[model samples]
Target: MNYEKRGGGSRSLPARVGRRLWVTAATALVLTAAVYTLSVRTVTGQRWENAVLAGRRQDETLAAARDANHMLDHVTVSSLGAAVAMLMLIGLARRRPALTAVAVGTVGIPLLLAEVLKRYVLSRPELVDAPARLSGNSFPSGHTTIAMSVLFGLALVVPYRLRGIAVGVCALWAISVGAYTVAAGWHRPSDTIGADLLVLAVACALAGLLARTGRVRPATERPSPLSALFLAPLCLVTLGGLGGGSLLLLESVVRLSPADPAVPRLAYAGGHALAAGASAAVTVVLLASLHRIDLDDPAASP
Candidate 1:
């Protein structure tokens, strides 16, 4: 969470860029807020709403979205985005006091749009049962937009040496919002992706305008050792077989007739456990090597 300054001088080239990004976020906040407020009008006859409910899986999709709803457990990314914005504001307090001014100036639009959208749009899945706290047009997902406004917006403040990583982090966070929204059945793929792009466009425009200048850095990554390991046919078949075998076992259990009492209920727990382990192992290894900030570590020097 901390970075050792790469070089020291009177706000070197990189520092200047960071300053500019903060400035851009400040200004863009106001403009995007204005646009969000002006753009959230409702359509007649529920055209978009009807389209989302189309298909045989319509009832199932609506049900899944309802099932996916949880108070705070699943309502994530929204808070994460706010926390990140708060941190940026705190960090930029001193040298970039103007950044604070910008944050203050434009905090109203996203909030206002979220509320307006909630009231104007009338197709929330939960509302189908009966109106609850969350209802209205979900044309643009709130969680997805927050992800863009905060993470993608912060990309400008990221050091050029680390901008790529910053952008990837932002993307991952944005994608997570898509997963949450779609899994919750609160938004269609079209809704979430569209919201994500609009947010990114606004963020980029603001970040770019404030950017005094830009520079490109080269990537010099070495291939990981595990590529050869995973490339083996045995490894591929083992991984695939484990996954398929686990699903087949589960399917067999699910399809068994209720009258057939002889079918062992938990026989494939062992197979399922094995498949889970294989998946976890692969994820753990990939995540462990994603980055190596050790080059900047004081002890890493010869």
Candidate 2:
């Protein structure tokens, strides 16, 4: 009976991990391909270009309060390198070697891929109706990728008790960066969306790999401290989405064209905001779901 119990229980863990790895890899590949196609092809269309252009030019209507470009300017390669180094230090301080490795792969692979895609794999096509559009490729916004990856990575290494708060903060940070890029004209909505999807795919793949390797096996655990803190951000995201969507609908009803300028720009900016909120919600959900699986928390919601 002892021998039978030992063999069966030992094999089950690997079998489960193998299944999760296969599923995660397949899903990630499909999502990455789909986002790549949309970003590279569909978003270059006149409609999308005009909407994005309007959003990018919203500051023109508002005149001078703040320079949106400031955010993108500071998110340079050097800044990202420093941020990564800081994150590594934090992970080491916690003495979680395996979790730190997972965090690095989750963030590092996506960062590398974002740069590669931006520099080589993708290109922004010329816009016919939107002749004033900015020149250069911007399929995957590097800033958004960096922000999201950092947040996601940090969430993975944080203690189980603090995971919920980390997830919430990460979601807010990612959304802010993504929205800022769209408003600053550094990237179109599709670029930021694609960046989020890409980061998510890489994070999931890395998580699955770690699980399969038995390097970061999930252990049954207590619920995180202040789990309710996570709910507030998710609620805020929902409200923001609803408000933005309503504004968009009103703009459409009023027949505000890109030619008129101000109203359309307002609508476009609202759309960008909505996208940010949606992306945040998705990120939060993903983190929560993964946390439940990783910690073996039976009380976690779907």
Candidate 3:
């Protein structure tokens, strides 16, 4: 059942695919959350919107300035941000070998599971108030889920030296996205919360598995102090935000660049596929390289 293929010389290709699956899950979760909220609003009638929606709850921030146009925000908010933390922990796992196992296992297994759940269970997003441009099913917030997984996944592996800061940053990013989604009228507040919880559950289960693998201590015994200070949580969020922001900027640049109307469709799709593939490839490489840094260069160890 362990889909995690052991690395022979370095990380196996399965590992790379498995890692990419993690980001895919994260990306898919946001779309899925959007879809789920629409369905919930249609059927359930005001699940989270009527109650917990902080943005709509009191936001009143809609102005002529227009909402922020953030597409790859999910990449930074969910994957890039958590990825750095998860990878950082993986690096630390060398000293805490058990944690290293947890990091890889958590990042690997549930990633696959999240995808299957998205395709079969969720409905696509479509509503009058919802963003017209979006096209995908949503049950759980893929973005929220991925964000939680990366941050919480770290809780399973980080040394006592860095647990508080790790969790704090993770929570901040997820919360910001959740708030923005509600404010942007993209999803009901409850849907986002549910997705966040789902990711936490997935992450915790993965952590437990790693513990069973003798990678880290048990949850009850894992004395992770609640160090999520207001300012402290802001630490790694910039990394993800910047990555996503940069990609968006590149997209703008691409749009401004000279176009090829000769073969528009193929080039457009190819360009997108290339970008997605590249973003995903870089994410995996960065994650794996971060993990292997100490092993590849001993002096780098803390």
Candidate 4:
């Protein structure tokens, strides 16, 4: 397989990479702000999210709650340590220390940022007369952050050839975790969306750093088409089906009066579907952005 450099003539590789990175990071930041504003700072947003929480008892079965709890139980400090260790092992095995460091940063930075934003920087004001359970600030959920950061970290470190397979498998877990956060009433749909976007912004920034440092290169071999063929349609279908379904569900909620008996159930279902769709969209974005680039061997770089 032949790998070609990305630029020609006056345009430099680093320049191109940096431009793309800035654009993506800016977009993620704007989206994060939008999620916070629309979902946490607005009355309508608060009403719907609170309604979702209220409906959890009706929609979430005992077994389903248990399953969500069991899934969340896996997101402990020990598991994060193990995940970091595994990512480090991959970098060590490949003899790419820079890649390893970036991979670790990709995981650690978002987790820390999510905590800071949820705890200190951002706040959920008393925008609506909500229950005590729904009063606190829970944007950029820690559990969803952990799941997404780990998935993005794994995607960052895996070999180019295996990138699609690795992301495809891990995306399912990440997507499920995001949805489970809502299903368990631990987070709102926007919380999961915020986490996904935070991870994406950090990942893009780090990839840009790698490119600027000359630690990124074009792939030497073509990625397996089968992975794309399989994963692309899967993501598209998920995005379209769940996204469309959630819109319809939420549209009904919007049209109905707040006192209607069906509002809670509709909002809850819509929020759940929205959470899953957001995760799927994030996975697709990360895969598309990363599939073409390979981490350069540090020793081989000039």
Q: Give the per-residue lDDT of model 4 (tens digit) for 1-302.
A: 22333345212555566567767878999999998998899988888888888878788788999999999988899999999999999988988788888899999999999999988899988987867878988988999999989988988888898888778877888888999999998998899989989999998888778877666666667877767764775487477747774785667556645668788887887888888888888777777676566765453353
Off by over 4 Å in 4: 1-11, 297-302
| Model 1, span 48-91: residue lDDT tens | 22222231133345554455454215445567557556736653
| Tens-digit lDDT track of model 3 for 147-181 | 45565456445554455556455555545554455
Number of the top candidate by TM-score?
4
- lDDT sort, best first: 4, 2, 3, 1
Candidate 2, residues 42-160, lDDT tens digits: the string is 53343544555565565454432144566667777787888678768867887656667778777789888988988887766654445554555777778888888887787777766
How far residue 44's Cα lies from its native spot in candidate 4, in Å, is 0.7
For candidate 3, the lDDT comes to: 0.42
Relative to the true structure, candidate 3 reaches a TM of: 0.47
What are the lDDT scores of the predictions, listed in order? 0.39, 0.64, 0.42, 0.81
The residue pairs in collision within model 4 are none
How big is the positional error of residue 42 in model 2, measured in Å on the Cα after superposition? 3.5
The better-scoring model by lDDT among 3 and 4 is 4
List the pairs of residues colliding in candidate 3: 29-141, 29-142, 30-142, 30-143, 32-138, 32-139, 36-138, 98-215, 124-137
Q: Could you tell me which 10 consecutive residues in candidate 4 have the lowest summed lDDT? A: 1-10
Better of 1 and 3 by TM-score: 3
Q: Candidate 3: lDDT of 87? A: 69
Give the better candidate number (1 or 2) by TM-score: 2
